[model samples]
Each structure stands twice: as structure tokens, then as C-alpha cells.
Target: MTPVSNGRPVTPASPGSLRRMAVTLPLVLALSACGGHVKGVMQPLDLAAEPRGNAVVDMLVATSRQPSDNPATLFSGERSALPSITDVAVSIPSGKVRAAGTVQWPKKLPPNPETDFAVVRVQPLATAQQGRDWVHRHASGGHAMVFIHGFNNTYEDSVFRFAQIVHDSGADVTPILFTWPSRAKVFDYNYDKESTNYSRTALEMTLKALVEDKNIKDITILAHSMGTWLAMESIRQMAIRDGSLPKKIENVILASPDIDVDVFSRQWSELGDRKPNFTIFVSQDDRALALSRYISGDVQRLGQINPAEEPYRTKLENAGITVVDLTKVKSTDRLNHGKFAESPQIVQLIGQRLVTGQTLTDSDIGVGDGITAIVAGTVNTVGKVAATTVATPVDLLSGNIRPLPKKKPADSGATFQSESAPLN
Candidate 1:
């Protein structure tokens, strides 16, 4: 009998693979407990009485999911004929009351702004012009940060997480979220993977629009897990279509990427020589990527690579990609898959350094030399005790770090087929 996963024929698993799955499946399920219970969290609340000290994150959300009929559930985890845009404001409890790098999910309906992350307002952008206007108003020094969320995420999940990141990182860029359809079920991995493929063109169009916007000077992309694949494919398509990516799109950060290692190599190679500076956050102990590796014919996943090991070390160094190895960064995240966003130090690194087009260095990381020693190795490192930051193309190992040259913008005549519209 042929093996089937999610109604699709898959290669038969080896005995060892099946044994590993038996051991890892339970942990994956336990770690994925956050999904399914929280629905309609995006429903705006009357936080008029909320205290002034609370932090509010105003984000522009673009999604390819069909709009939900319920106002609280603005978008569903299903494919849409076109992309939709909305402006959402999320309120996080003040620093005095809440810790950074944490999302305080409401224990009940009508989340209390005093403790939980709650939606304060929701507005539909009636046109692309409105989105552009929002960018102009919120963007600081023409800088924008775009976030693409990973697998098993609901619309509300993406919104709140990005809100936490923006609030914690204190990044001075306009926040935009590109959320694709994710069923938010542990067993729906295949469905979510296919959804990413389905939404690739929409993401490509969204990126092109940002590059063309006169008000946007620089853009930084942060993508996690399965979203990394989507982000890479979109950029590859853009490169193939336009000769080169716009220099304004400066930094691309991949965290816990759920991508096949071989496939990632090909994708990276296809981005052409003038690609944006790439930084990847990797952990060898990520259980999620381990499961993904098993499902993907037992091939190594990019996120679980040992950057210090052979081939990867040479390949990453040769490509001029900065790698942040987070294997020793202890986190409350049992799955060890989300250390990038869940760790306060790491998230701040994203906002304060990468978002502003600044390279990470020993002095930049407050952690002591122990962590720095690992990160300072051939592959840059950040863990519990020390942090190492590497400037691209500059060899930190050789102690020859220097500022990167200014990049000239690439000209492109590529046009996108419009697939975005305002929500009703």
C-alpha cells in the first residue's frame, strides 16, 4: 500500500524515520497547544478606559486569506481570490506590568488592556492609495519592516506576535504583516505548506509595491519557519523578473526556517549576485525542524543545521550571509523553534540593529564573552551568555570588519497583476 499524508502520496518512511516520528510527534503536539483555542481574538475591544502607559502598535496587515464573516475573525485560514489590507492597532500592557518578548493572551473574551494584548481598533484600507498613505504617515525616515509569520498561525496570532515584536524591539520602522492562509492545526502542515506556494504571487506583488513606493526608503524582512520559504521564493521571483532586487530592500532575516537544506541552497543561488544582505537564525536543537526533516524524506532542514560544521560553514561564509546560531539560548519555548522572537535579547537585536541596517558586533551585544566566543567563531553566534554579530562580507574571524559599501538601486520595468482589494 502507498503511504499517504494529508491526502497526498508521500514517500514511504524508513524504519528509523518511523521510530523518530513516534518519539517526536507527541512533543510537537504538546508544543503546538496554543492553536485552535484562541479564535476571534482579533475582534476589536472597547479599550477607551485603558491606561495611557500601555504601548499601542499600529500595523498594516496584508493577507491572501478570504475575509471571515465575523468581524472578530477578520480573516479565515482559507485561500482568497485576492489579497486584502487592514489597519489594526494592538495594545500591550505597560512595561511595568508585563515582561518583554511575551504575548499576554487574554484569558477570556474582551481582553483587559491592563494585562492582555488586545485589539484597540481595526480599519480597512479602502484602496492601495490608503496603504501608501499609512506608510507615509507611520514610516520613520522612510524605513519599513515587513513580517511574514510561520506555520500554524491564525490571523490574530500573527498580529499579536508582530505587535509584541514591534513593541519589544522598539524598532523605528513602519510595521507591515504579510500573513498567508494557515489552518492553525498541527496536522495540517502539508495544507499550510501548499498555501504558502499558493500565496507566493500575492507576496511578490506586495513586495514590489513596497519597493515602488516613493515614501519607503529602506525595507527589512523578518520571516520565520515556513514563511521563510515563501519569502525566499517571492524574492527569487522578483529577481528573475527584474534582473536584480532593489537596493532599498536592505536586510532579509530568516528565523527557524522550515526549509530543505538542499532546496535553500538552490534558492539562495538563484537570488543573483546583487541580493540583499541575508541573516539567518539557526538552532541545531529545534524539534519542529527535526520533524520537518523527517517528513521531507529525512533530508536536513536549514534551520537545524550546525553552522560551525563543514560544508555549511564554508558555504555560508562564501555567500557572505551572516548566521546567528542560537542553540544554547535557553528559552521558555519548549519546542525551541521560536527562540528568535521569544528571547528578549534576540528580538531587540532585530529591531535595534538589523532593522536599522546596522551590523551586530561584540560591543553591541551586552552578553558576556562566553556567548560571544561561540558567536565570534567562523559562524556568528548568540546564545544565553554571549552574543556575536557579524557584518556581511566582512570576515569577523579575520578581525577585518569594515562598513559595507552603499548599494545602488536597481531599475526594473516589471509589473504585477493586481490581486489586492479593500475589505468590505
Candidate 2:
């Protein structure tokens, strides 16, 4: 039986990373849980009881060792910093699966890398070189999509999810994932924030390293939820460091990013629009961001934008950024926000369009075959062009094609339609 922590339920999870609670239930369900190996803080939970739920116990009893819970060790000398995590599992999901990665933190961190910020485990999707290598082996001549996950996810889930896209779309290129510190624990708000804070420099360093390396060509960073802040801040810091984004940095795709739009605007002004082709995947049905909204005092949520309330999209679009508003789509249990990445069809859509350097219009990802179709048409308000009409190009990823309708032939705001579009 599981014990209760301060009246909240607590249960020992199956041996797995605490990230992606929805995907991996019972793992994060320990009593009085305040556990996470985030970058900044080094806190651990004191679980009183063992397995509280039947499913959790069953999973634990049934599942094999997925290199479970063997996180980056902490430093004995440095209480403030994290240890190195070098655990690199390079196996793709042998089947349809979802996963993520982390900058491996050492179990016992030292003063230097620890204080300077230590990463216990990082994804094999390491430097752009690694990304390029993967691309060389995979498809070629396509834009690279680097997916950075947000708060409270395990390294495995994030990796697997992105892999699903890469595997599905068969986009020929390396898919790099920047793994930060995610404690995978609930209610450890401050710790998670600290993780984000500490990871900023590391992310920039990663980008800078890639900029110097020539193997990786066109690249893009796909950030989700709070991961958006990290991506945004990384770009901002890069400018502050080198006075501009590195030449290699091609585009950025912010999918339901957890960020203040106004703050983002300020950062955008600093970075300028020309550096990285920026595309924002915003949705109105984002329940997760809604929770963030309530916690943040009814601010303009980045993810939850309805078609009627497309002000942020209008603003960003006018500013020459591509904004694909998924408000017309439906919201799932977590929120419509995460569905952009969680759902299979959506992942397929991302793999097909964005990864292929396809431009999008309202029609492509607007309806039918899942949310990703909205990406088929080119929608960015390029070069201070005040929201003019750009016909949906017949070939979003190529030279020239027939002109298609800018708007949808038949708008299906909420209607779900099955499609057999190639997993491009």
C-alpha cells in the first residue's frame, strides 16, 4: 500500500525517469514528493509508503530495467551543483514509441562542472556534428529539426516522441535533441525553474559549438512548452555573446511555447527577424498552458489562442514571423497545447512539413488529417509585409509549383477527418 504525504498521495513509480507523468503514470506519484535532479537544486523526496496504486505496482513488477532511475550523480563537495550524466542510449524506439533525453548529471558532482553547471546525461542527439552524421546516414537535403522539451518530462519520452516523427516522416537529416534537467517531480516548481535557468548557458554553448562545426547544414530548434523560454533565451544570449545568431542557425519552431509574448517580442527585436526562420505553433485549447495562465494571473497564454483571439498571431505574423494558430483544432486532456507534439498525426505532420522545409498556409495544417497539415502552406508575413496574401504554393518544400488557395476550400474548424497523406 502507498502512504500519503501531507494528505497527498505518494507512490513509488516503476523504475523509470519521472518525466512525462501522463505517459508514465505512477512513476511521479510518491508521497510528499519533492524529488528531481534538476540542474540548480539537488533535492530528494522522502517517500513514506511504497506502491500506492495497483497500476504502478503492476508496471514495476512487470517492466524490465529501462536503465531505470540511474541518473547523473551529484557532487559530494558541491551541494549546489549537479553531477555528470553520460548515460547514452542510442537505440531508436524499435517500434512506435515515445522518449526523451537529458544532459547526464554525475551522481556525485564536483566543484567545477557542478558549479559551472554539470550535465549528468545528454542525448546522443548531441552536437550538430552528431546530428549531421545521422543526417548523412538518413535522408539528405532536408532541414534539421531539433526538438527541445519543456518542464516535467523524462529524457526518454522526449527522445522517443521526436524519433517517432523522424522515423515516420523519414526526413533525411539528423534530429538533434537538447536535453536539459527535468526532475520529473510534481510540485518542485522552484527546482524546475532553476533547472531552466542553469541550462541557458549550456544550450548556448551547444549552439555555439554547432556554429563552429561545418558538418551540420540547415538547422532548426523545435521547442515545446517551457522549453520555448530556454530556446528564446538561448537565441538572446547568443546575440549578446556574438552580437548575432551564428550563421548556421537556420530557423526556430516554437510549439505551444511557455513564454510571455511581450517578452518574446522584446527578445525578437534584439535578435532581429532575419537570422532564424521562426514559426510558432499556437493553439487555443491548451489546457496545460491554461493552468500556467491561472498560475501566472490570467496573462496572455502563448498556447491557448482561439481563432477569434488571434491577436498574438496577428502581432507576430505582422512582425514577419510564421504563426500557425492551432486554435481551430481540439484540445486533449492535458490541453490542446501538448497535442501538437503528443498526437501521432501531429508528429507525422511536423515530420512531413516543417522538417522538409515546407511553407504553410491556413489550409495545410488547418484541418483534416490532424493538426500538422496546417503546415503545408507558407504563412509567414515576410519582410514587414502587412499580412498580405501569399498563395499556398503547390510545392511548399521545393522550387516552383502550382498556386493553391490561400484559405481553406472548406474550413473544418472542429471536424476531424481521416487522411492518408504520405508521412512526408
Candidate 3:
């Protein structure tokens, strides 16, 4: 049968493809579970009684999504002519009741503060000046972190996830969330892809404003799934517009990026010689990327590549990029596409090291030793050492690491033909 996307009929699947889909059907269902939860959970609720040790995350939200008529749902999944900025505070339950790397979604409205993550305050920032003022007030040591969420995410989904990340990671930098219009439907993949394209300029403007701000000494960008594509495109656009990116834009982390491998190579080349410290989190077991690959005419997705393999390893190393292979690090996410934020050790590495402009290496000691220690601990618990390799420009120029081996012939049969292959 032919598959339809955005109401248009597409290519029909072969019998082998049908078998593959049947095998990955469970993963698709697991991925869709989040969509089954209560919508409009963004409605702020007053806590009847203050819970001890509750952590509050204050974030500046900039979105290109149209504002919802209902106050509870601030933004709807539709494109807006202009961007909007708002300040929101989400209250996370105490450490005793909640685990790290998890968002306690409310089961119903007027959520329980002792258990569910509830909204504490929401304030609109009328102008860019107000946003600058907010940054001035919140930025710690002049450090700011911008988070761009992935596909099939609502405004509330982005907000809560960022809050959980900030609180769980204990990152001291000011948090900013840049959310685009995502219909939050499992089947609206085309719409979501186009939405990213529509909002790239807005994101570029946001990044430009932050880079120009004197108050923000350093900026770190963390983007997940399809958002990584948006992030790369925005930065690439910035480079094209202005000869180079400002030095203040320090690091960029792409988690489970959904960009085509060939496209990402082009994006990286366009960034010029001077660019942010680039780090990517990859998983060969990423079922989500598998599905994405199938939908994108069998093109390989950057996030699902086997970094240890031939061309990727040499390509990544030559580009001076750090790679963290999380194929072995188990997480609650059945799709295995969110290990960057869902794994406690990995998230801590982001806050303690990466965001601080510190490069992660197995040999590093002193202030950055936490990365090694955490990796060690994770190895003991997960029974697999998360492979982390650094190929920084400095390391390559200094000849600190050994030479890479010769490339082998590409595996012709490794595409998504296996019935055991995961979903995207």
C-alpha cells in the first residue's frame, strides 16, 4: 500500500519494507506514547502547600509559533509572522520524589507540586530590550545556554523538557528555549520539517542578538533531533551573513540530530575555519533515525551513524568534532534518540564540562575530572563504557592523538533492510 504524507500519496512500500515496519511497530507505538498524555499541561497551577526542596527553573522562551487564544496554551502549533518572547518558571518536585533525567508530567490540570512539574509564573517580554534585561538578571558568570527541542514536540513539551534538563543537570547558566511550530503529531513529519525551515531566520536572529549582547560572555547551543538541523542551518546562515561567528558563541551540542549525513557535511564546511566547539551524541541503536532514514529515501541520518566505522570516523576526526557513542548506554527512552538528555551522566557532562567550554577526554583531570568519573560510574552500572573520543582542532594540530586506520569498503547491505532495524 502507498503511504500518504500531508494528504498526498507517496511511494508504496515493498514486501520487505512492510516486514521491517511490522517488526518496528512496537517502537513506533512507544514513541507515540508521549502524544497520548494530557495536552495543555502548560496551564499554571498554584501550589496549595509549598513542597520542600522543590527546584524552580526560570527560562526565557522565544518562539515563532502563533500565540493561542486560550491563555493556558500560550503557543499553538502554527507559524507566526513574528517571534514572541516570554519568561516562564517551572517548579520541579524535590529530589526525594523525582529521579534525575525525567520530567514528571501532570496527569491532570491543577497538578500536584509534590509530584508533578507545575508552572509557577509566566510573564511576557514586550520587547527585545526586556529580553536583554531578563538575560542580564539571570545569566550566571555571563554564561547562557540555548536549547532547541526536536520534532513532534509542543510548546509545553519543549518548556518542561528544558526545565528538567536545567534542574537535573544543575547548570548555572541562564536557560533560553527557542521553540518552533511542531504540530506534535507522529504523522506530520513533513509539516515539522517545513516548520524548521520557516523558523530558521528567527533562530538566527535570536542567536545573533545573544552574540551581540555584552552581558552574555559565552553561549552554548544544545539541539535535539530535527532541531539540530535548524541549529546548524541558523549558524551556517549567520556565518554567510557575517563573515564569521562571534568568539562569544562558544560551544554547540547536537543530540540525536536528524540531518542527512551529506547535508551535515556541507553545513559544517559552510561554518568557515572558526566555529563553535562541536560535539555530537550518536547511537547506532537509534530507532527514530532508522525511521527517518527510511522516509528520507534511504539516506543515512547523522545521528545513527556508526562513528567507529570507516568514513565517518575519518570525516568526524578531520572536522575536529567530539563524538559520544551512546549505543550501549541504556535509557528509559525506547526510541533511544534522547540519550543526551535522558542519561544523567551525559547531562551532567553537558553542565559540568561542555557548557563551560571544557573539552571532554578520558585523560583529562582536575576540574573536568567529573566527566571521567561519571563515565566510569555509568560503565559500572550500565555494563558498557560509553565511547567518547575527542578530535579537537587543537588535539589534531598538537598531534596528541594517534593516527586513524585506513578506510574499508562501505557495507552495501547495512541499510534499513533488516527486520530487526529500529525506528526513527
Across 1-424, the per-residue lDDT of candidate 3 in tens digits comes to 7678999999877899888788567666766875566678777776565688888899999999999977788999999989999999999999898889988888887788989898888899999999999998997888899999999999999999999999888888989999999999888889999999999999999988898888899999999999999999998788767766778888999999999887786676456446678888888889888888877878888888776665666545555577777877777887888888887878888998888988777553223422211111111221111112321111222223332332321431111111121110
Q: Which stretches of candidate 3 lie over 4 Å from their true place?
A: 1-17, 23-27, 47-49, 363-424
lDDT by residue for model 1 (251-287), tens: 8999999988767766764554565767888888898
By summed lDDT, which 10 consecutive residues of candidate 1 come out lowest?
415-424
Score each candidate by Cα lDDT: 0.78, 0.49, 0.78
* TM-score computed on alpha carbons, candidate 3: 0.82
Q: How does each model score on TM-score?
A: 0.83, 0.59, 0.82
Clashing residue pairs for model 1: 371-386, 372-386, 375-381
Clash count (model 2, backbone only): 66
Candidates sorted by TM-score, descending order? 1, 3, 2
RMSD of each: 9.9, 16.2, 10.3
Residue 81 lDDT, candidate 1, scale 0-100: 79
True-vs-predicted CA distance for residue 271, candidate 1, Å: 0.8
Instruction: After the best TM-score superposition of candidate 2, give how far the Cα of residue 315 lies from its true spot, in angstroms.
Output: 1.8
